[model samples]
Target: MDNKNRYSISDQSIRFLNKYLNSFSPTGYEREGQKIWKDYISSYVEKIVTDLYGTVVGVINPNNSPYKLIIEAHADEISWYVNYITEDGLIYVSRNGGSDHQIAPSKKVVIHTKKGLVNGVFGWPAIHTRKSLEEKKPNLDNIFIDIGAFDKKEVEEMGVHVGCFITYPDEFFIMNHNYFVCRSLDNKIGGFIIAEVAKMIIEHGIDLQFGLYVVNSVQEEVGLRGAKMISHAIKPHIAIVTDVTHDTSTPMIDKKIQGDIKCGLGPVIGYAPSIHKKIREFIIDTSKNKKISFQRLVSSRYTGTDTDAFAYSNKGVLSSLISIPLKYMHTTVEMVHKKDVEKIIQLIFETLKGINYSKEKFFID
Candidate 1:
């Protein structure tokens, strides 16, 4: 079979993706999820290195090539931090990484505590009890967690206190066998794609002339903290960053403001200040040659993903962004198309196969 035919998503991969996506990996607390990811990719890579902040790197063809290349994704997910526990045992929260306040009401949550997982629910008054015109919406101050505690002292006694990390209790599932839905797809899917690409290259016995860094970064929900630090340390010659973009085809999103990205179309290639022209063209060419479908996006200033972090780091490495179009990003029901995921994996794998120093070099002449 040819390389294209040989690369296929197996049942084991789907199982891994489900497990990894279901795992909680809130910002600054990504160690557990990172361990799961590292374990999955361990047998497929030659060596692995971890940073002080827990950004995991699986190295391919390590120490054999001077040129370094990176295919990266952030592992952290948007979550909430317990800001204050009221005297009546209601828990007010703050954003951990752009956690959407509007979606909090009536949702189930897991508050990570010293004891273990504490179940809670975001409480809201029934619409019938409130004046429709005067009804307040779910916001930072209004949304609170009810864990069945009667008082603040009981809440603390139950191991729930300020600074505890909170995440939606939503698990991964397929919709109509086409859409992958769950919280945190903004980036756990990115990590999954890179891992799949690495698996394909290794299982097929494909040799690379340059080093490949499969990076699962942390603190992206807070900022591009992990990517910033790791890019400087690795000093890679080229970087390909992947993350989720909004599927504007969904309701309430204006296509004029957000462009016309959709779930089932394909992966989206971004044009941004951080994107290197030659690298961008090469990726587009690879997509065309391999017959992989893709969409286009333009970012005026920044891509707002780790692409900026890696692109501007280490005296400016050549970098570009490829995004998986997702619906309801940052919400518990975030969804993506299965075909886009597979195509992205193929695009990255094929692009890497075509990168030869003698044939194509990064030059600005």
Candidate 2:
């Protein structure tokens, strides 16, 4: 371990990361995950507050300075909700937030209910039963979950009902010692990374003149709802958003179409209409000054993340994106490289460190 062990990610933080990522923070139902986030970041910040929709904010320097800055990431993961129950207890679902039905076959899932969780599996037709050419593709209409119940009555007895959320049972994992593989890493990893930033700031004893709002937003997958409400409330002058981008180097992904980015290469900085050019340039400058390698990409109409929410809120808060290159996004086995994770943390930390309100004009040219 280095001399700055506490500043580095500790074993305890890793434990928290696993638990947080494993928890059910499905869209519109993020209270459990918000509790986890608030508890973990409580000691690191001066104050903590949650909005009506369960968006948690850890405030480091609560004040009214024009330099108010927000480091943000969404907390919700894509999920499904029970839409119907068959006579034989098979459950049909509707996407809660961009939940991919294409990957549903044979995957284990857990149905959340008022009573508790009921285990289930997404069942598909056996290969023998499926005709080679006439086999039906997996789609929202045909995908369903079986909970080992004989009838709908038995399923009801087990406490599952319509509107109850369902999530994958897949847990957090590290592959090849550097790749983080897990469900919901799309934005939950963003929450983890921002929390680590707060922890490091406390450990390093760095004080900021402006308020640092560390926001873990909810319902971003459902169209940035969580960030929308909270960003309007915080009205931060500068917002730095972190979320995942596709690892186009992976098989089946066309680099020309998705942009040439890869995990273990570096964090991807997004240029978009929502991204303020001056603030974006500031991040690029920070990456260069700190010698942190970074990749670049462009988003046309929207960044498809929380950056759009904050950028256009409250007279347009300066916003930019720092994305972790992720493979298999919106799936059970989302993967990100530990090296890029480290660089993203370093880059954001350095940017925050160098953002001196007294000397910095983030957007004003």
Candidate 3:
């Protein structure tokens, strides 16, 4: 495809990403997100299935191959849940996943209550009321959400119940020429990439030697729970875990510590023990041969992604991580490059075509 066509595809994917990010589908509350993903991906793939935990699994080659190839992207995003309602109508909430408390205060949010969606803003004590020492980072527990209700009874009447999901009400926007910012790009972007790959595979009719399973998992931010379950069930010979990594463009980040991955470069091919060396080599070689821009990220220990879960699942699976370099991870305004997103989709499609499942050794020696 030409550059213009490739950019068009990326732009379409960005639209999908925005819609998914804007929806309220945090952690345990993933039904809405799943419905959206299902509706978009159902007609493109050969078959689709939803697991017990609401993980959406799309199968392109289900019957022929002996080995299964599982690609995972979690559907859940970081969010909060209502914990208490004060007599004055203020709602106290507890975080559901890995959320930066510092960014929560003063941000607009949507509470997915029993009756309907109620808009609110995270509120905290003013700086003027705090002592000099207390002006430092305050605890998240002290934060509350104000929805303009009169009292606790009024708030309850508005259908704000305990355990209702609360998420950042941020919309996706293009920052510069190539960079974009939004909430929940961490794995929503990953899910969008997987779906885009599936669409390409279907349109091109690429012959595959192994069965491919594109799984949109749930609750990865908490502890990779969805990956653990799906990997165990699929028991694939090989797996690819897709997620986001730090861009480190802002101040206070050490370049040497996080390697040289950046937002506009391309997707970062992960190098870790859990990642099969042969698969990593195949991906790198394919990117080079295809003349696609790519970057390398080294992880000395376990990568904090679904790869960690898939590595040890069942008897043990050979798993690798393909990360999109993202700035401001786990925040309301996460940023990613549009080129990097397209590169990741191409890399994944090309890597799958290069797999040699009949080999005896797992890693290339």
Q: What are the lDDT figures for the candidates, one per model?
A: 0.91, 0.89, 0.83
TM-score (C-alpha, index-matched) for candidate 2 = 0.96
Candidate with better TM-score, 1 vs 3: 1
| Model 2 whole-model lDDT (C-alpha atoms) | 0.89
Task: List model 1 lDDT by residue over 21-47, tens digit each.
Answer: 999999999988999999999999999
Which scores greater on TM-score, model 2 or model 3?
A: 2
Q: Whose lDDT is greatest here?
A: 1
What lDDT tens digits, residue by residue, belong to model 2 across residues 97-134?
Answer: 99999999999999999899999999999988987787
Candidate 2: residue 327 lDDT (0-100): 93
Which segments of model 3 are wrong by more than 4 Å? 1-12, 131-133, 358-365
Decide which is better by TM-score, 1 or 2. Answer: 1
**Number of clashing residue pairs in every model?**
0, 0, 0
Clashing pairs in 3: none
- Model 3, position 58, has a per-residue lDDT of 93
Q: What's the lDDT for candidate 1?
A: 0.91
Better of 1 and 3 by lDDT: 1
